[model samples]
Target: MARDPYRLIGRIQQVAHSLRKKSDHLLIDSAGVTTAQAGILSVIAGDPGCSQRDIARRLRLGESAVVAAIGRLRGAGLVERRVSDQDPRAVALFLTARGRETIGRAQETYGVLNGLVLDALGVGGRARFAELLDALDSAVASFPDRPDEAGPPGPD
Candidate 1:
């Protein structure tokens, strides 16, 4: 039997989208925070003094998108920005008390969602699935940034 790789990839994307949509609903309803904001808060919580650029790179998001999310999070009193001690020109991000609480809730929501996914994969498949995902991520990370530059020769 022949395998259709595109169909498999589409299924993966659909599952990811569904998971994000459901988790976003739960997060917004319970913690009053969007998934994007929760994600930024998580990154800040993990790296207390991380810069917006670092967040953008880690999240694979555009600088402008990160900036807008940070603005909304700051306006909502969930995050705070301060001048970096080492780099005066750069800004460091930190979570507020409210942000901490929200992140805790977000973690719980993620835990539940992860459990569902893991269950679907079963105990034996879970580890292998995780390894496959990590491998795929690593491979994708090595690709050229611009689609136009993605031709056979190599990145310009």
Candidate 2:
């Protein structure tokens, strides 16, 4: 996008930062929802009786993070928590009518933002981009913490 990445200038981290900033700002302005809230809402919309622990595992967030976000969503009247029928100690999450409406708005906004990427990448390019991204994700997942990663390139 800005010449090949070298260290910090053209790296994907910069692109991700810019994209997140703009998208987050736009969602906050137009949808009355943050990205995190929208994601949580979507999860609940998909699974009407999911627990907060389920959300934490699915979103790969800490339990505390899910708890805090759910607190805010509850305060906003977007989500309601009820005692689980299967486990009295656990709470199940459900989206309120307002949460569903906000999630719909957020989806519309995301499609609008994704439209820009589609136009830039074209249809075929987007497919290749997704494939490449998945490869990168798989490769980087469970990366070792030591500096031994500085080895020669492997077969790609």
Candidate 3:
């Protein structure tokens, strides 16, 4: 019989909460960015000039939610938008210098949180978990489409 995949899915939410809590604690004491903002910045940092639609797709976020995030980031001078050269109708997003600095700090906080999670798992456990996750990911990719996401998760 197949194991309950929902348990793994449910555990992921718990892990997300733990990471968010740790990120919040670090930001309050060491930095000044929220975890959600950090995630947005991280995605922007990786793919500069990506559209808000791309970000929403990458993050599995709603369009309105991504727009709100972009607004906050723009207000903070952490992100900037430019009209696409090829298509005047589209806007591309990039991180400002301040945004890069924030992302740097966020990376540190992320490293700490990652260390906590991986350390708890140990090296062997981490390897096995990664292998299982990869296999599951491959299995899911065989499907025609992931109706839940805007598009397939892609090579994340």
Best by lDDT: 1
Task: Estimate, for each residue in 35-141, the C-alpha lDDT of model 2 and write its tens digit.
Answer: 88888888999998899889988887888999999999999999999998898998899999998989899999989998998899998899999998898878777
Q: Which candidate should be chosen as best, given TM-score against the real structure?
A: 1
**TM-score (all chains, Cα) for each model:** 0.87, 0.84, 0.75
Which ranges of candidate 1 are over 4 A from the true structure?
A: 1-3, 146-156
Pairs of colliding residues, candidate 1: none
* Model 1 error, position 14 (Å): 1.2
Off by over 4 Å in 3: 1-12, 135-156
Model 2 reaches what TM-score against the true structure?
0.84
State the lDDT of candidate 1 residue by residue for 1-156, as single tens digits: 886886987888998898889988988987888788888899999999899999999998899999999999999999999999899998999999998998999898888878888999999999999999999899888987777755578567
What is the descending TM-score order? 1, 2, 3
Residue 133 displacement (Å), model 2: 1.1
Candidate 2 Cα deviation (angstroms), residue 24: 1.0
Q: Give the higher-lDDT candidate: 1 or 2.
A: 1
Model 1's TM-score against the true structure: 0.87
* Backbone clash count for every predicted candidate, in the order shown: 0, 0, 0
